[model samples]
Target: MAVLDIKNLNVAYKSRNEKVFAVDNVSLSISEGDSVGIVGESGSGKSTLAMAILRLLSENDTEITGEIDFKGKDLLKMDINEFNKIRWKELAVVFQKSMNALSPIHKIGSQLEDIYRVHEPKIAKQKLKEKILSLFKLVNLSDRVYNLYPHELSGGMLQRVSIALSLIHKPPLLILDEATTALDVVTQGQILSEIQKLEQDIKMTRIMITHDMSVVANSCKKVVVMYAGKIMEVGNVEDVLIKPTHPYTQGLMKSFPTLKGEKKELSGIKGFLPNMSEKNKGCIFAPRCSFVQEVCHKVAPKEFEIKSGHLSACHLHGSEIN
Candidate 1:
């Protein structure tokens, strides 16, 4: 069974004047031990999708629809109490900023203890301390660092601690929302290597959400490309990253730098994401797409199968490669 399955999931934010749909009818299934990357530019709702899965959005500002099934349980229907039971046990989140995630005043050890204290109540305090120490070792931290506060550790160490805390319960799914965004290249590589080791060692499933295609290309087995709150494409990482069917995907790949080749100036997508509250008549990317036609401006394109296990939402699906 799929560890995570989201179908027709839609999320909207409310204001006094209108509702803004941030995620629009997106569907995805992640099997056990699978590594999936959701890639998109900022404002494309990639982070919102992750937050929605965790049921972390503030209820007053947002409305969610459709299903978020985790191991046959409908997460959308779970009450707060039941959801709390699942948060750090069945599903865990490694948010984008480790600084914001870790508490400044609390000792690192205490924070680690809190995960077990909340979820695995049956365990005694002594056992929890032992487990937290074991977790520190598992993430390659020195035992002495456990007593240090968040400010005492380096950025890399804090991020590693954040990762260790997230794995405290050995949850089935680990959602890394740009977890390495703040680190240097060397540190990021180290963390990525550690993540790969953990995945292989435990047969864990991971969902890495990042706009960096290089990270997605190196880490994920499957890829989902999002643009303006809609999925532009989904396919095997090798196939989609190497031979992107969507124009947007192609543009993203072209923008990546290579060591052995001549360096070119990097450029971002030209136009802005359309306002969600505004009435969008057709494809959301039509304004920025270089290959857009009249049909793209007048009607939304249906998702078409470009190859086995490769699908794209573009008008040129059956035509010449973009």
Candidate 2:
């Protein structure tokens, strides 16, 4: 069975008497031990989907209707108390800024110990120390850095600490929301290598949320392309990245610089994402698509099977179906 399955998920926030849609009618699935990348331009609803899965969005002001099934259980239906039990133990997240995620006032050891003790309260002091030390080593951190303040560490070191913290409870699913965005290129490469090695060792499922296509190419086996709150394409990483069928996906690939092959000037996609407050009557990307047809501006396209395990939502790909 797939480890995570989202069905007909929709997320909208109440804003000035109107509901602004951030994620709309999206569905996806990830199997155990699969590394999936969610990639899109800014305002493409990638982060919103992550927040929805984690139940971090404000309930009172947000309308979220969906089935977020994790391991056969609907996370969307779970109560706060019940969900809390699974938050860090079964599912953990490493946000964008590592420094902000860490407490500025506390020592690294204390903060890590606090998190560890919450899940294993009865663990003796010596055993806990050993566990923390092992984790630090796993992330290639020295023992001396344990009692240091957050500001004492470099950006790369702090990111490693964040990764260590996420794995402290051995959660099967780890969501990285732009976890490497703040670091230098070298540091980002190091962290990606560490993640790749760690995944091999633990066989954990990971969801890497980033706008960088190169990052996805380096780390993920599968890729999902989103645009204007809906999925545009999803398939194996190489297939989706190299042979993108959707106009939006193809445009995104053209905008990035590829390391291999002859170098060419990058071309960016034209037009901006439409305002979320406006109700979409047809294809959300119709205005920006270079291949947009009259039918595209009048009717939204249904997802069509391009090949085995590959799907694209585009009127240009095949005959439209109800």
Alpha-carbon RMSD of each model: 2.0, 2.6
Candidate topping lDDT: 2
In terms of lDDT, model 2 sits at 0.88
lDDT per residue (tens digit) for residues 94-130 in model 1:
8877556778899988877875778776888788888
- Candidate with top TM-score is 2
| Candidate 2 per-residue lDDT over residues 1-322, each given as its tens digit | 5999999999998877799899999999999889999999988899999999999999888999989999989999999999989998999998887557789899999989998888788988888888888888777789987899999998878987898898898788999999878777876787678777777888788999998889999889999999989999999998888888888888888899978999978999988999987878789999998787899888999998988878999988733321
lDDT of 1: 0.85
Steric clash pairs (candidate 1)? none
lDDT of candidates 1 onward, in order: 0.85, 0.88
Give stretches of model 2 more than 4 Å off. Answer: 318-322
Residue-pair clashes per prediction, in order, are: 0, 0
For model 1, give the 10-residue run with minimal summed lDDT: 258-267
Candidate 2 clashes between residue pairs 3 or more apart in a chain or in different chains: none
> Which regions of candidate 1 fall more than 4 Å away from where they truly are?
124-127, 138-140, 260-266, 318-322
